[model samples]
Target: MPTDLVTTAGQAAGRVADALAGLDLAGPVRDLAAALPGGRTATLAARPGWAELAALGGRARRHSDALDAAARAYLDAEAAARAAAGPA
Candidate 1:
């Protein structure tokens, strides 16, 4: 439970969360669907695929959030322990 490791984990999780939040999981497929002549058919065909992708993205974001929370909790606990031990 080294503070440096905890901090690094938090930072890594934050980066992952940012990336996941910014992801455009369905944008490419949606664009392709719109560009096709039978746009409606393409859209229908891709509907399930995009939906699944979105769901996976949501799950990944949630996991990232959990990781961040865990890292924060560890840091907080370490701080509390140091404070309780007082004066080195």
Candidate 2:
């Protein structure tokens, strides 16, 4: 039963990651990936669970954050490119 709950949480995390992917931002998403573990840790602190939940959540959040960061980086780079092209 706990595994099932963890699986559901994992799926939810994946969905969030997918949504973040839709955004267009700038740079590598690595920074976000690096910070994701701690972010997820904080979230789970509010509600404890078995190691499976923690592991699943951490992985999911990292993937999600990376996706979001990529989108943000893409958008920022595009904006900067446009601004640089305009007259000074």
Candidate 3:
């Protein structure tokens, strides 16, 4: 069975995922990761050329998926940490 993470980290992971889910490239110009406390690290996994493509008016869904996967990895690592810390 899987373990549950500490409430704080779980909350952080969930917020990251929720923010990814809410991304809107066309709605308004805003930085999502900058808004989170540790979001800079979270965006490190984004695709290498997302902005260049966006600047060229190309689709960025694949890049977004890469970013989402990175967020999920963080969540998974957090869960692993919780497991290592012992049962909740």
Encode model 3's per-residue lDDT on 14-66: one tens digit a residue. 55555555455533223443444366544653435434423432233344445
What lDDT does the true structure give each of the candidates? Answer: 0.67, 0.54, 0.48
Q: Model 3: clashing residue pairs?
A: none
> In terms of TM-score, how similar is model 2 to the real structure?
0.40
Per-candidate Cα RMSD to the true structure, in Å, reads 3.7, 19.6, 15.8
Model 1 per-residue lDDT tens digits across residues 1-88:
5656655665665666666655665787777777785757675747755645545555666665676677788878878889999986
Stretch of 10 with least lDDT, candidate 3: 53-62
Q: How many backbone clashes does candidate 3 have?
A: 0
Q: How far is candidate 3 from the true structure (C-alpha RMSD, Å)?
A: 15.8
Candidate 2 residue-wise lDDT at 3: 38
TM-score of 1: 0.54
lDDT of 2 by residue, 26-78 (tens): 22233343455567644544342323433554566786556555556666776
